[model samples]
Structures are given as structure tokens and as C-alpha cells.
Target: MLNSTQVSYFTLGAYFDTKQVKYVLFLILLCLYVLIVGSNVLLIMVICVKRSLHEPMYMFLCSLFVNELYGSTGLFPFLLVQILSDVHIISAPLCFLQIFCLYTYAGVEFCNLAVMSYDRYLAICHPLQYHALMSLKKVALFIAAAWITAFLIVTTTTSLSFSLPLCGNFINKVYCDNYSIVKLACSDTTVNNIYGLISTALVVFVSVGLILYTYMRILKVCFSGSKQTRQKAVSTCTPHLASLVNFSFGICFEVLQSRFNMSSTPGAVKVLLSLYYVTCQPLFNPVMYGVKLSTIRSMWKRLFWVKLK
Candidate 1:
């Protein structure tokens, strides 16, 4: 019978008794956090410091790396703390804040990818006009728009969920989620549901449409162009395509877990699937881009070698 205001904390029911293995879990997660932070920060620094990388593509990449860092930070530290503590409770305010951070991170991730695809499209399909189309100023604007729009959309989402009158304070997941909270509302969630549907549709459709359209155009150009052009397209677009597919799969798993009843599923598998998108994408993108993209790969290697000397 408690409303949201009366609900001081939320219990995260997803965590199980790891017994003494929590220490092992903690160490493993800590290493993962370090790796994610280190790899992403390294790429960001490389993109920013290298004068040769000061192009639209790298700039978009830098933004992507930054978002990976932002998104990972939203989850890892809190997750680390919860892993050790017996109590998996998060304060209502902190729960809302995490929702804001994570949701915004997701929104920005998709938008950023869409923007990068367009940048690639312009680079390969319209080489002469690439610079003009994706100038530094425009790149800056695109990055800003991606971030700002995500913030605004997630802001509305979080606010709507926060204002709901909750009948309970138990979230069945390891972290805060807007849908889970909305489902806990004692009052009507018609507005929240409507807005959620609309925002999700817009974000998904727009970002996916842009990515598909740009890739289609890029593919058309590649097929008709010279061998060198085809090679260039393959080289540049492989990592991006891989990244998009990987993230999409992770998101699909999460959405399915969230929206559907998966109680019959194994608990461990469910937990992993729930965390796959946020956890894997941060680690995945850095590795994929670092290894696949020669510019970043060579730059990081040269810098490491210089330091070794």
C-alpha cells in the first residue's frame, strides 16, 4: 500500500547467495571494469591526441568510446558494490538515477552508431563531398544532438516513472529499470506506457532506418565501384557492422527477458542475458574497433612501443 514517496528503498531480488564465491565474483567483475575503462580510455586518448585521426570518422569514434565509458560506469561500480554487500537494496533516488544513466546510455549508443554509419556512408559513397557533408562543426553538432536528445528522452522517461505511485519497492533485477518500476505502479500507467511506446518506436525506427539506409547506399556504391573502393568499404565497415549486430543481439535478449516471463529459464542464464547488453557492449566495442580498425590499432601499438622504449 506504500506509494513511491513512502518507498525509501528497493530490493533487487535478482542477486543470489553466492556464499564465499562472492569474493571471486567481486575480483572478476573488478578486472572487467578495469579492462573496460582502460581500453575505452585508451582509444579515446588515441583518437584525441593523434593529429591524423582528427577526422569526422575518428571524431565519431571518439564519441562512441566516450559513450561506452559512460554506459559502463553507470553499471559497473554499483554492480561491484552490490556484489559484495549482503543487502542488495538501493535507495529510491539512487535507483532512479541509475535508470536515468543507463537508459540515456542506451539511447545515446544507438544514436551514435546511426551517426557513425552516416559518416561512413558519406566517406565511401561520396568521397569528394564527405568533408563538406561531415565537417568538424557538423560532427560536433551531430554528437551534441545525439547526447542531448537522449538525455531529454530519458529525462521524460525517468520523470514519468519516478512520479508513479508504487505498490511495492522490489525490483526483480540487479539494476533499476523503467519498465520494471512502471509495472510496480499502484495507479494508472497508461501515460507511461504510451510515452514509452512512442519514444521507443521513434528512437528505434529513426536510428535503425538511418543505419539501414546508409548501409544500403554504401553497399550499392561498393558493388558498382572499383576493387579498391570495395576493399575500403569492407575494411572500414566490418567493425561497425559487427558492433551493430552484437549490440542488437544483446538488446534483443534484454528486451525479451524484461517484457516476457522467463521464470522457467535457468537463473544463471537469465542473469547473464540481462547483463549482456550493458556489460558486453562496453567490452565488445572497444575490442572490436581496436583490433578491426587499423588506424586505431597501429596508433595504440606505436604509443605502447614508444612508452616501452
Candidate 2:
């Protein structure tokens, strides 16, 4: 068995041709990371400080905002450094750690959206019993479950991956990933592949199923109710739907890239799609929630207006 130090490093192949525009890419990514952090932090602060916004929906939103920050931190820092460095190599241990963080982010994101959908479903479909159904304890439990479940799931996947002996260390992507690492394994990867598939299927199917069912029930109620009720539903659910769609599209691009032969695809396109969820989703979530959610927008405007005044 090779010792940890003897394990070879992986070259981040996604940066192979960006030398000419490395600074440009670095600046763009840095700005994006800053915006993600700043916008999510602003929303989180507003949600935390505003006693009036202490409902289950806002609480769930707070959990998502914090998660965006967590997810972005996993990728952006290393990416920024790689953009400037001549060698775009990462150690095996760090690669595994990154895989854990990025995958956990994706997992937790799915859980958060699913829980948020349920919160909306209860509020809209069962308004009379919303309070009892979505109590503080319940909301807290759901949020904790999202984090804890994601952590444990990714922890197991990462552990299984670490046991495999790698034949090579060339990762043809911008960042470390579970699939990429597993692809380099010299040993039998049937177990890792099987577990990864099962875990991913469970997270995806369960989350998507919950979202679709809740939204369907929500839509049914909206159509049968008064015009005011319909408008309220649209206004409140729009942000969640938008965020979900954005995240879904990113996931779709990634899955397509992984499942299909993308040899003819442009390197830039591959990089963008690969990094889409990590980079864009983090920024998109807060922007959608901050602008589309009326309560958040009004509070944000007032806070800025007061600061300027």
C-alpha cells in the first residue's frame, strides 16, 4: 500500500489552455465569489436580525443562504489560487476533501429545497394547521436533517473513495470531484460506483419528488382559490421555483457532461458547465431570493436606503 505522501497529485486539466486569459478569468471569478459571499451574507443578516421575518419559510431561506456561502467557499478559494499559479495541481488528500465539500453542498442543497417546498406546501395548502405542522421545532429539525444527512452521506462516499488505489492522478477538470477521482482507481470500483449511483438516485428522486408533489398541490389549491390567493401563491413561490430551476439546469448540464461523450465540446464550455453549480448557483440563489421575494426586497431596500441616508 502506498503511503499518503507517496500518492501522486492530480493535474487540474481545465486550466491547461487559459494561460493567456488567466488574469481575466481570475478577476471574473473573484468578483463572482465576492458577490456570492456579500449577497448571501446580507440576506442572512437581514433574516437573523429581523424579528418580523421569523417564520418557517424565512428560517429555511436562512439555511439556504448559509449553505450557499458554505458551498462557494469549498471551490472559489482554490480556484482563485490555481488561476494565478503556474502549476494547477492538488494533493490527493485535498482533492478528496474538496470532493466531500462540493458533493455535500449539492446534497444539502437538494435537501434544503425539498424542505422549503414542504414548508410552502403546509403554508399554502394547510394554512389552518400551518403553525402546528411547521413549528419552530419542526423547522429546526428539517434544517438540521438537511445538514447532518448530507454530511454523513458524503462522508461515507468519500471514505469509500479513499480506500481505492489510484493508477493515475490526472483529473481532466477544473476542480476535484468524486467521479473524476474514482475514474483513476486501479482497484475494482464497482462498490464505489454502485454506492454513488444509489446515493445520488435517492437524493435526486426524493428531493425532486417532494418538490413536484408539493408544487402540484400548491398549484391545485391556487387554481381553486380566489384571485388574491393565486397572486399570493405566485408571489411567494416564484423565488423558490426560480432557484430550483436554476439549480436543476446546472445539475443537468453536469450530468450530461459526465454521461455523454464530450470530446468535441469546447474546453471553455466544459469548464463552465462543470463549475456551473458551484459558481453560479451560489450567486443565483441569493439574487433570486433577495429580489423576487417581496419581503426580502423591501427590507433590503430599507436597509440600504437608511444606510445611504
Candidate 3:
């Protein structure tokens, strides 16, 4: 729905004039979204039902999957529709909701990763007091804290992101995104850009950096001891490590590409980069968690009608 006042720009290479190609792409995206939802839901179900997975580490991973579903669903479906229809119109209120959902999930995902990393650090570095320190009640408290922190971060980002007036109507990207959304605002976004920088630093530099430092210490402890201890440490933390690397790699790329790369990018590069966040992210989480953890794989098998009995 385009108003008389708002100026809408046509994004090249995605004109929805052709019926066949649009429908085909829509079908493909719908399948991918279904696959993502199904996989993450199965991951959650397996963790809940399987007695073997009721541990601190898997709990963190379960939360991560849930948040991933939240983040991906926020934009991917709408984006698919926009691309298929070749209409990029979005109402102002709906755009705010999109930012809220995306920011919440992203913040929660960051906190959950940090929490998992710390849990691994404790388990690997302190074999003796691990049980007492990472008890069920303590894990619950940590999750609660993560949720609260995520809420606050989301509140701040949303308040700032959405409060700006939208005199200029069009968002440049495929979905309701931070960069594209900000560019549509009527006012100067210097402060918003600064906040974006801070947010990126907080996630990539502060949270992941500390996690890496802890993992390094944990690795030191693992390699110094007996062979069995080394193997066990690697086994316990490997899934988490993989997830951290997989997740952080994309985020770091986003930060650098947005902030540092001063070159003028073409439309194809924009779509490809945006697809990394939307399409690649959901797929990565399931593969990393499901493949790395045997329990999750069994659950995933059961989910897809594979007989486990």
C-alpha cells in the first residue's frame, strides 16, 4: 500500500513481473522455511523428551534453537512474499514489530551463546565443583537472566530504531532490517549508527571474545592432563565450540561489511549478503547442533518419521 507522499524506489533484478519464476522462488523459500522450522522444533522436542539431554549445555543449545526460529521467522516469510509479489511496500507499525522480533531474538541468541560458553568453561576448567556450580536451579537462573537481558537490549534497540519518523518511505533491503530500515528515516541517523556500532562490538568483541578466552583456558587444561581427560573435554565442548564459530563468523562478517567496507555494492551483493543472514543462519544452527550431538540426531530422525525403536 503506497501512500501519495512516500517515495518508493524500485529494487533492480527482483521485479515480480514474471509469474513462473516468482512462483518457483516462492515455493523454494517456503520449503526452506518449513525445513528450518521443522528441524528446530524437532531439536526442541528431543531435548525435552530425552532424559539424556537434560543437562546445562543442551539446555543452552535448546534455547538457542528457539531463538533462531524467532529471528528467522521475523523476516524470511515476508521477504519471500515481497520477492514473489515484487512489491516492497511495508506499513510503518509492522516494520516496528519486525525490528522488535529481530532484535529480541538476536540479543537472546547472543546471550545464550555467551551463557553456553561460560557453562563449558566451568565444566571443562573445574571438574570437581562443576556439579555444584552448574546445578539445575543455577541453570534456570542463568536462563532467566539471559531473557531479562535480551528484553532490555531489545527494548532499547526498538525504542531507538522505531521512534524515528519515516518521511522517506522505502526500505532498501528485502526485509525489515536495521540498515535498510534506518536508511528510510526522515532524520539524521548518526546516533543510530553509533548504537549499531556499540551493539556489534558488544556481541562480537565483548561476548565472543570472553568466550574464546575461556575456551582457550579450558583447552589448556584439557591438553595438559591425561589422554582420556583431553578427549572428554573436547567431546563435551565441541558442539558448543562449533556453534560459536558458526554463529560468530556470520555476525563478524555483518559488522565488518556494514561498517568498514566503503565500496559501493551492487544489488546482487546486497541480496546475497542479506540471504546469508536469513537463509544461511537457520540452516547452520540445525546442522551444527544435530550433527555434532548424537542425541539431537536421534531426535531429528524421530521427527522426520525415522523409526528409532
Candidate 4:
């Protein structure tokens, strides 16, 4: 049994031999990383620079886009490198750091979505008081709270996983995972497991509960209110609903993959399932919002036209 200190590097057991296809995979992932970075940064810039988009919804979106960038950057670069490298090993500190980055990214993503749902509830259900309710200060505070809460949660998780003395350093996934690390512990993991369950429940239930509650209120308004009210709810809430559903599916798959034995599953499928949440959500949100939101669409078109001119 190797002590945590003796386990200087963790071998990722998931990467099979890519051989000649490695270059193709590398290029594909590189392009994906570039697109994720470019699209998200553009959206963030548009929101930040345009005074018309200074409202609470767009402010929350800016935070969401920023998180997409953060999360994608955490995985894509390492993935690109690993795809090309023969040795699929990550240093202990880097592994833990990746675990921290990706975990917090997931946490922040859920919390940000929850906050956006609340913002929508205010906009649709309380139009008259929406501005008063979701002022710039409150928006800032909400965004801060979302990010800070995720940071604190993932920080504790990563710290606990990092301190464990590992019997083995082989992770059966493409990237560093906190649960996988806990499973490698030579010492008792009662604390880690207990904390993991508590934190997971806290984040999932609270975020999902808030989203459900807000949407219920929004639906109530749409049903009883005028046609304009219904249209408003449909227009604003559709993209959010789509994003939430897509993200939830991805996270569910990831959680299942991490916790359960899926050894019988094909390697490629397993890899795709593991990468889906991190890759797809970031790619999905920008495109979804850009296409779905009229104001953002118009602004994006105008910006493109100006650039062309």
C-alpha cells in the first residue's frame, strides 16, 4: 500500500490505445476546446460591453458563460494532451487540482442554473417589481453567492480526497475524480463517504428544488395571466429549461458512471458518457442561448454585421 505521499502520480486506466487515430482525436478535441473558448468568451464580452444587456438575466448569463469557460478549460487542455501522450498519468497535485476544478465547475453550474431560474421567476411572475427585486446589486450578490457556495463545497471535497492515503493510484476514468480517489484510500473513508453523500444531496436537492419551485410559480403565472405573459414565459424559459434538462442528464450519467460498475459497457461509449457533461454543456449553452434569445440573437447579428463592415 502506497502512502499518499509515495503515490506521486495517478495512472488513468481508461485510455485505450488510440494509435493512428490519436491525431484525429487530438484535432477534434482541439477544435472543440477552441470553439468552447471562442463562443463563451464572445458571449461574455457581448454581455459585458453592451449596456442594453446590463439586466439581471444577462448578468446571470455572463456568469454562466464564464463558468462554461472555466469548466471546459479545466478538462479540454488536459484531454488534448492526454489524447496525444502515450502515458496517461497525472501528477498527484495536478490530479487533485483537476478534481477541484471540475467538481467546483459542476457545483457552480448547478447553482448558476438555479439562480437563473429564480431570476426568470421574478421577471415573469413579478414584472412590475422585477427590476426592484433583481437589481444590479442583488444580481451581483446572487452571482457571488452561487460561486462562493460551490467553491466552499468543492474545496472541502478536494481537501478530504487529497488527504487520503491511497492503496493504489490508478483511476479508472479519463480524468481525476474525487470519488475514485476515495475508493483508493488505504485508510477508512467513512468521513469522505458521509461528507460526499451529504454534499451531493445538499447541492442536488437545493438546486433542483429551487428550480422546480421557481418554474412552478412561472407556470402558474403563464396559465392565469394574459397571452403576452404566456409568450414571455415561453420565450425566456425555454432555453433555460433545455439547458437544465441537458445538464441534468449529463450529470446523472457521470454520477452513475463514477459510482457503479460499468465494466461491461463498451470503452468508447463509457468515454463518451464521461466526457458528455463537461464537453456538451459548455458547447450547448452558448449555442442554445444565442439561437433562442431574441435580444441576444439580434445583438450577435448586429455585432457580426459591424465586424463585417
Sliding window of 10 residues with minimal summed lDDT for model 1: 196-205
lDDT of 2 by residue, 232-271 (tens): 8888899899889989999999888876889999988998
Write down the lDDT that model 4 would get.
0.93
Q: Write the per-residue lDDT of candidate 1 for residues 157-267, one digit (tens) a residue.
A: 998988899999889999998899999999999999999999998777899999999999999998899999999999899999998898889889999999999989987
- Candidate 1: give the clashing pairs: none
TM-score for all predictions? Answer: 0.98, 0.96, 0.85, 0.98
In each prediction, how many residue pairs overlap at the backbone (N, C-alpha, C within less than 3 A)? 0, 0, 0, 0
Quote the positional error of residue 272 for candidate 2 in Å: 0.4
Candidate 4 Cα outliers beyond 4 Å, as residue runs:
none
For residue 263, give model 3's deviation from the true position in Å: 7.0
What range of 10 consecutive residues in model 3 has the weakest lDDT sum?
7-16
Error of 2 at 24 (Å): 1.4
lDDT string for model 3 (230-285, tens) is 87777667777776666666665555555455357665565566556546777778
Candidate 2: where is the Cα deviation over 4 Å?
A: 1-5
Provide the lowest-lDDT 10-residue window in model 2: 1-10
Compare the candidates by lDDT and give the number of the best one: 4
Kindly indicate the candidate among 2 and 3 with the higher lDDT.
Answer: 2
Q: Would you give me the overall lDDT of model 2?
A: 0.89
Candidate 4 residue-wise lDDT at 97: 93
